[model samples]
Target: MSWNIFEKLKTVFMKVTQILVKLFKKTNKSTSLTPVSNVIATPTAHYEGVQTATIIAIPTNIAKAVVNCCLKNRIDLAEAIFRGFGYGNTKIVVTEKEIIAETSSGIVLLDPSKYRLSEL
Candidate 1:
């Protein structure tokens, strides 16, 4: 029926308008603080050493151990270790074979099997 069609159209329009409003709100908030180009440029350049990548699945227990090691030690120390591996500004990628950290200098790969999380 025409009435059902109208109701569906109305629902679709309202949903679209809501989505636009939310998007605009986010855009306005971001634009107000700094130029969009500057905001975009800084993080990418500063964190260039950090990159994200997918790899073979890592075991859950190994992932937990790495996290525990970082938590048990000061987070800063964990950062330092990553930096030593040459991943100073990069996001780490974990894999079955090793954990990879990127630095401005080059790639650092660490064996998960070798890593043992020390207790605090």
Candidate 2:
């Protein structure tokens, strides 16, 4: 039994050695490995002191509409400044940046900047 086991192991060792030798020869015949490139890329445009500035513009269309509505109603612009506020809703607040309208359900915020004319 010992002789049979030793013979089996010796055959397996010889087969493994042959396979390793074949793989080593195949790899040895290949070319030397190298990098693809070493180029350091850079942008052509330079922004040294560039700063972002946002200018909030007035809504000319809304202003025009308000003026027309006041003209039609024959009321002063100061008195009819909030002519379009509070019908189905509760409190409505208008400012330079946004309009806050409070309803029975929730509060709505409308940005006046988005309503401005395209040229502005």
Instruction: RMSD for all candidates, in order, please.
Output: 19.3, 37.2
Model 2 scores a TM of: 0.25
lDDT of 2: 0.32
Query: What do the candidate models score in CA lDDT, each in turn?
Result: 0.36, 0.32
> Candidate 1: lDDT of 65?
40
Candidate 2 per-residue C-alpha lDDT over 1-120 given as tens digits, one digit per residue, 9 for 90 to 100: 234433343343334434544654788732221111222132111112321111112122223333333334444433322333322222223444443332222333345455444432
Model 1 earns a TM-score of 0.27
Off by over 4 Å in 2: 1-91, 118-120
**Model 2 lowest lDDT segment of ten:** 50-59
Candidate 1: the clashing residue pairs are 49-90, 50-89, 50-90, 50-91, 86-103, 87-102
Model 1 lDDT at residue 24: 54
Q: Residue 8 of model 1: what lDDT?
A: 41
TM-score of each: 0.27, 0.25
